[model samples]
Target: MERFVNWSGSLAFDAERLRQPTSEQEVIDIVHEALDRGGSVRPVGSGHSSTPLAETGDTLISFGRMAGLVGADKSNGRATLLPGTGLAEAGSALAEHGLAMENLGDVDYQSLAGAMGTGTHGTGRELGNLSSTLVGGTLVTGTGAVVRFGEQADSAQGQTLLRAAQLALGALGVLTSLTLRVQPAFDLHRQNWMTHIDWVLGHFEELSQTCRHVDFYWYPRSDRAQVRVLTLPGDEPAISPPGYLKKDERGPSYEVIPNFRDLKFDEMEYMLPLEHGLEAFRRVRERVKDRHRDKVGWRVLVRTVAPDDAMLSNIRQPTMTIALLQNASLDHEPYFRDMEALFLDWGGRPHWGKKHYRTAPDLRRMYPDWDAFLTLREKCDPEGVFLNDYLTEIFGLQGAP
Candidate 1:
């Protein structure tokens, strides 16, 4: 048996079989085999997800062999990529064609399919998560059939499938290819500075509204925060007080948007309504300062995401995401659970790819189209070929093998 470990080493499992399929036909054959054997299959990407979304005891499929830019349409600003293409790889590939993703998350190590499937996002008041850029794709459904959705879908049912597939957490099917909305290559000016957490809380709205990208990291021990804002080269300058500048630079959007993350950490993030975001953050800050300050040596991160219609997307409206990150070697459950209560009280939805305790009952209330997604999932993977114990439990799938 081969043991599979995630990026943070937070989740690991010994799989009975681990295979990397180099082509879509191979992926289809693997699925068909799994179905024939009454076994399950799970897709593993860069393993960036903190949750056990890709865990499976039966078979694990790695898409590393199936990565690259398949097509580029400079005229339409669209690019088709393989499921295993890394975000960084995609950025470079698109840049070669004078195109770039509209936005990107801080870390670019995740595979394009995994990022879109998990609704990974970058910070911007108007930009939606990466999933929102998913215009079309092909996935091998649980029934061992290849289905085209998104722009390729010609019917209302196909569109509905696209919505369900947008952020299905790998439970819906094995995504083999993804088409994303791209833009002509551009550059951005990035600025970073240290400030009091209070200042950030006070002017967060203004910063978020004016900057193309704005996020902050709150350090509990010092009651201070580090703010980062990115804007187009000629856009209005970020408001920063004297002597607060930490970094000022300009680069291509691909280079400027993502930051290298060397430290390994376990993260739990929740998306809360923008209206209650500040208040929730205030309460979380107070509680962390009072209760977990002694054990916590990490910072709390805050960012915003625009809403999209992905059925299970965390941001249903303008959303503020609060992420608690603890050193991977340290115990994070107590602190994470404590903050999760605060988030849930404020109608927060857990990031599907991150750590959370929410189950089907809690999730049903958070998503208006929960049942519809569930129905589609069942329709696609009736045999539960793509489901593992973790997914089965969270989805409340009854009698799943």
Candidate 2:
């Protein structure tokens, strides 16, 4: 019984039965049997989600054994993959055929289904999340029936299936296979640096215009911050960091925090008009320094994306996301409160897969089509078999009987 947790350095759930069903029929049988006994069933992938969406007492299914590149449509520039395939592996396999995903997240270990379930995304003002690349997929519902949907001429059905697949979140059912649209291979010319916070804020618009991919991360408790800017070939190029430095990991520095939830931190993030990104980040930095007396670390990362239409994506519009990472040994609640207040003032929306304390009421204010999303969830998962404390608390989902 091997058990694992998410990559955020938070949350773990030990299941009574952890089964790796190798075939579709086996998965169907497992779900049906769980229902027959009046129990719940949940499927887990790489456990990369920060939230405990996969927690279940009855049965836990892992898709690792059911992974591989099942088929490819080279002429149409598409590929059919098993749900358990790793994003990195999929990217590499597609390269062999002179094809590639439109974009990818920072880490590549996530399975196709798990990443799509939580709307794992990359950077690009016009590009949506990875799930947007999905042209079609096969979802095995709780009742053990496989339903395939995507690319219907009927606008309503196409839009419905598109939203359903964008952030399945394991509530809908087990995803068995995925078919994704691919693009011709491309390369990135990456730049890196440590710079003043003020300079970033003032020049964000110009920066976004200059770069193909732009993103930044801030380290709380430090005056200095790292910055990254990437561009495609034939773009106006300037000085970039030493090639070696640009390859560095740009997230939080490792620390031995026993309880990640209790760690004190503050963050302000927003999906800014791509042109306003540099200045938006700069404003956030200025605010943090003035408000917190404790030492803080600072950094900024930037990346690029092609294009897609996933509803849950931050890059649905041309967006520049600024993530502020704070470090401290105090309680996290108060800092989050202050941070959220500021984010609201600045019109920021929370990232779906990251840690944030916004309630449904607050979320309603942030999202315009929140009710529509709720309606979609109800239609696919009427029973709410996948509802958990996190989903209910954040999205206000009433657990299905």
Candidate 3:
């Protein structure tokens, strides 16, 4: 039976079997079973990734059985969570301990593991992506061997393995649990205003530096920009939200950071160097006006993330991610492809879990650590038990037919 589909319903697969393992031992056993059967396995979380990263031709594994807070390190401000733990749930748990994940994207539906695995990030010029906070991880490898990374391993290979695994996209193994660096719970003062596209560009650098979290949402068809900024509460008082925005809100950092995502859409996000971001936006604006204005109503979200060294992370440079959105009910390929071309011309890197047109060869040139990641993948999952068609294609493995 076909047991699953993604949130956007754009990607789906009929796995020969579906397994939700409640324990790490079960995960290890499933890997062994897939190996024994000469079939590959793919791990699925909340199915938040629009790309087919988790789609598999054989066995599909979901970590829902292992959901929720597993443990916490009060002294060091860390939390070890089962991969299936929902972001919002983890946020609430962290709050109880006077802590929270350092940053978060607007939508909180993704599992913690999925977020960390795919380089998911919040908008903060000084803050890094989710993978950047990974202090340790435990996973069952393709060889059916359980390995602990981060603090557990004491060699250069182990450290390199941690860097690769932080944003691995499941090519290496099935992550059972992860330890993340957290911070004390704090309040934020958020403000929203509707402004012109030109104004946002004119003050891009200044605003980005001043605000802890800021993003610009522009509807290309309409040519209007909604400027949103979040900062620590200060001597200033709350103000009314601008007419174009939902509302100005303030609360716990995690609670205030994510907006309710009721509108479903397929997305393609590309990380461009800060210097090229505005230029790319201008080009996309011209192209949208000249070619595909009618197809877009969903806003283009542009946000920032500081650099990090997770091998597959697109946040390797202080960058801005331009996320193009399309209503899930409509065809998106042509529009996304056009934007992909624009991004590529700007030397941008695609977000691993989002829609994109890059394969192994194209990606290798974009990522300096691409070959290194492939080497690690080979050593960890030599038999390809952890690979799916998408992983196979990206990592240059022989995809299972």
- TM, every model: 0.98, 0.82, 0.95
Q: Model 2: runs farther than 4 Å from truth?
A: 1-4, 152-159, 219-222, 234-236, 240-279, 293-316, 326-333
What would the per-residue lDDT of candidate 1 be over residues 162-264, giving only the tens digit for each residue?
8888898998998998989999999999988888888888888888998899999999998988989899988855476433888888998988899989999
Best by TM-score: 1
TM-score, prediction 3: 0.95
lDDT per residue, candidate 2, 1-401, as tens digits? 44556554455666778888888999888877876776777778787665577877668888999898887767888888888998877877777777777767756778988888877777655556687888877777766677676852246675666666667677777888888888776666655566654444455446656675555545555554455665664563464432234342221111100012434333334455555545555566667668753644433343334444554554455556655544433344455556556555656666666556678888776666567777766665556555666677778765545
TM-score-best of 2 and 3: 3
Off by over 4 Å in 3: 235-246, 399-401
Please write out the lDDT profile of model 3 over residues 58-124, one tens digit for every residue.
Answer: 8888888898777887788888888999999999988888889999987898998888888898898
CA RMSD of each candidate after superposition:
1.1, 5.6, 2.0
Top of the candidates by lDDT: 1
